[model samples]
Each structure stands twice: as structure tokens, then as C-alpha cells.
Target: MGRWAVATERRRGEALIRAIHEAVLAEVVDAGLGQLTMEGIARRAATAKTVLYRRWATPFELLIDALGEAYPVEVPTPAADNLRTDLIAALTLLTDWMVTPAATAVMAITSERGRYPELAEALWDKVFDPRGGTFTTTVLRWYAARGRLDPARLTPITTQIGEALVFKLAIDNARTPSAEEVAAIVDEALLPALGL
Candidate 1:
């Protein structure tokens, strides 16, 4: 291809990718996962069905790509000096994410995981593990630097306490915890669990 032709093609490709991502989220939000289909996506995105087939082999692939593109996991900076403050900040960021439309997509994927084991593995490997892993590593490093991360006490279980609690509140109760609740989790649960 000529230089301008190559550039034009690249722009078109980028736009198609954006459209596909948007269509996936909109479809799930509007119609739920059951009604999400490749044909429907192509129609909503105003792209050729061949384009989607060329890029993604299955709805699982498309959905995973869209979710990853839409909700890039963000691990926040520590809030303040202490572990309590920092842990609360990290957990709070997670709480905020849990309530977003992107998280609704996540929940949908998770709910379907039992039926589609590969999809669950992909979601964890591609999306959840990277983001959650980074945050967990950051929290551990922060506490270790402060000489507060106890070797025996600060295991994966302890690290996940705050996040677990928040997720429990969101999943079991259908409510995101208040700031006070987050603080209580940090002060009463995470910090003590970490032996900090």
C-alpha cells in the first residue's frame, strides 16, 4: 500500500476497534449477555460481520477484548502515611470500580464462568489477575518498606481481606460499603490481619 493509503487504513482499523468495543458494552448493558451476538454487534457497530469474524473467533473473545479495552484496571496511589489509610484507599478504589458499568460486564462474565470454563480462565488471566495482582503487590511492597508487613501474618489471605470484604458487600448485599465501612474494614480487619 502507498504511505497515505496505509495511514488511512490504520485510522479506519482504529475506528472499527473503538466501535466494536463500544458495541459490546452497550449490547450487554441493554440486552444482557444472552442476547449478545456477533451479528447484533456488527449491526450496532456498523461494521461488516467479516471484520468481527476476522478479528475475534467467538463472542467470548470479543467480549473479553471489549471489557479489557473499556476497563483497564487502575491501582491507585497510597492514600496517606499509614497502612490503614493506604489500604482503605486501595480498597475504596476497588469499591468504586465494582459499581461501574464495566464491573457489570465483569459480573456477567463471572456469572457465566461456570458454564464456560475457558471464558472464566481468560477473564482471570487477561483482566482480573493482572489488575488485582498489581494492587496486591503494591500493597505488600508498601507495608514491607515500612517494616509493617509481618512475614507469617501477611499472606495472600491477609492481603485480600479488605478487597474480599468489599466484594462481599457488593455481591452479597448489593451495596458498596460507605467510606466509614471501608475504614472499619481497614482498621478492624486488614491492618489487624496484617499484624500492622
Candidate 2:
């Protein structure tokens, strides 16, 4: 293949990876984790088991890459001048997406990764670590700009604001968080952490 054709082919292969992930995520809703397997994934994705095995040595490794693709959890560089508002918007977006079908794959991948070090490394490096690192940077920048930046304060700041929203859905099983709730979280919880 030509260089461009080779690149296109690789992109197609990556699409197959995504398809397998979606298939598995659907199983989580329909049947849950017990149903996950390469054979099941290939059957659902309408591809072949040999194709999946050629691309991945094991299912956990496959799931790790799926997490990266599922999470578009990039650092928000919003133009809102008020740092608090910007932070709230960014964090809200992050939590909102976590309730999606894509997130089912993320949870499955994370659950699997705990038992497999190499799989954990792949997911952390490609998915969790990068997004967390970027979010940390975004929040710190916002705080510093507001003259409220303190290294000791960052954890409390995010947890009180962003993490509560996450836990509400994770623990409380709420369907979706609202804009008003996000605003309240930032105002009542996050601002207090910054001592504002």
C-alpha cells in the first residue's frame, strides 16, 4: 500500500476497535460484565475473532484502547473570562459524558485493568492520566488567574465541585446532572473550598 493508503487502513483498523468496544458496552446494559468476551465482541461487531486476536493479545488490552477512544476528555479552553464559570463549564461537560454508553466501556475497561498491570498502564497513559493531568492544569490555571491558586487547595477545590457531580451519578444513580445543579455545586461547594 502507498503511505496514505496504509494510514487509511490503520484508521479502518482503529474503527474496528471502536466497534468492538461499542458492542461490549451494549452488552453491559443488556446483560452486564459477565457477557464480555472476544468471541461475543466479534459476533456483535460482525467481524471475525481472528481479526480481533491479530490486533490484540487479550481482551483487557483491547478494552484499554476502547477507553481512550470513548473518552474525549480533553482540557477545556473555554473563553469565559470568569475562571469559576469556566471551571464549572469544563467540569460539567466531563461529568455529563460519563453517563453515556461510551462510559460503560470506560467502566468496563477500568474494572478489567485492575487485574492486569500492562492493561492498566495502557489505559492510564492513554486515557485516565492524560485527561486527569489536563484537567488539573486547567483548574490550576483558572485558580492562578483568579489569584486563588494554592497547591494544597486544588484537591479540595475540584473534589468539592467536579467530583461531587461525578459521585452523585456514580453513587446516587441520577440520570443527568443539570446546569443549575452544576452552578450550585460551583457556588456552594467549589467556591467555599477556595475560601471565596
Candidate 3:
């Protein structure tokens, strides 16, 4: 078979969904959320629009699924009680994800949430909520459950420190924070907030 024929081989199940997810994320980043369409995603994924409709009713639903698929879950060191290290790692994951197409699409949705409130709501309900809410939350909870951290300290404000600072620095600097910056956020902001 020719290279063209080989490249056109049909994808099914997980493979097809992965391609469609990637296509939606890329489409949102390249075309913006408001411009996203089934046709555009199908064109990008090299699949028929009908294939997209088979799984998702709308491009926004597809985009939310893509973001959820791409979102990283923080895995705390269960045996080791290194809160600082785990917190830094969680924020590092956030910084790494911040540079991805999925993250870009998420930012696009959140930035224009007023225009697309439902999309933003779905993003939180489907993506962020399912994935341990936010960076450092899982780690903090792990530490708390083990008595390494006080459960009382694991409040909403404390859990959000690392993410809020990471986002603020990224917005202010217009770039993803470096590893050193991620570490500093854990040490300076998150640890202090947790009373450690």
C-alpha cells in the first residue's frame, strides 16, 4: 500500500477518541472557543463530523472531555511525608500543563466565561472537580489524613494558594513559571499558608 493509504487506516475506540480530543483542543487554541465547530474538529482530526456527533452533542462538550483527559492528577508520596516536595511537584505539574494546548483551551474558556458561562461551569464540573479540584489539593489532603498536616488548615483558601500564585505569576510574567518558581511557590506561599 502507498504511504497515503497507510496513513488513512481507520482508528477505533481509544485511538479515535484521543485523536478527536487532541483535534478539539488544537481547534480551540487555534480557532478560539467561539469559533470551534464540529466541522473544524473533524477536519483537524481527519474524521467525519458524524463521528464527532456520535460521541458528543457539541464542540464544547468535546472540548471539556479533552481538557479532562489532559488534566493531570497529583499523586502524593504516600509513604514519604514530604509535604514541600509533593506540593512543589503538584505545582510543577500545573506549570507543565499550563503550556499545553488543552491548558490554552481551558484558559480561553475561563477568560471568556462571561460570554460562555455554561462552558466555564461545565469545565469546572467535569474537568477540575473530577481531577481533585486543583493543584496541591490532593497532596494537602493526603498530608492531612496522615496527620502530617492539620485537617483544619486544609481549607479552601489554603488549598488554592499554590494554584493562585502560579496563575498570578504566569499572568504577570506572560510565561509558564520555571521549576525554581514552582518550588518557591510551594516553599513561600503554600507552606506558609498551611502553617508549616
Model 2 regions lying over 4 Å from their true place: 1-11, 78-80, 107-126, 133-137, 141-148, 156-161, 169-173
lDDT of each candidate versus the true structure: 0.74, 0.64, 0.89
**Using Cα atoms with residue i matched to residue i, what is each candidate's TM-score against the true structure?**
0.77, 0.71, 0.95
In terms of TM-score, which candidate is strongest? 3
Among residues 3 or more apart in sequence or in different chains, the pairs in candidate 2 whose N, CA or C atoms overlap within 3 Å are: none
**Residue by residue across 64-156, what tens digits does model 1's lDDT show?**
988777654444344425666667677777777776666788788778878778877988788767665534446666667665665567677
Judging by lDDT against the true structure, name the best candidate: 3
Worst 10 residues of 2 by lDDT: 72-81
Misplaced by over 4 Å in model 3 are 2-5
Cα lDDT over the full model 2:
0.64
Best-to-worst TM-score order: 3, 1, 2
lDDT of each residue in 18-46, candidate 2, tens digit only? 77878756755555555567887778877
Residues 1-196 of candidate 3 have per-residue lDDT tens digits of 6998889789999999999999999998889987999999999999999999998999999898888899988999977578888888889988888889988888898899999999999999998887778888988878878888889998889989889999999989999888889888887877888888
Task: Report residue 169 deviation for candidate 2 (angstroms).
Answer: 6.1
lDDT score at residue 183, model 1, on the 0-100 scale? 88
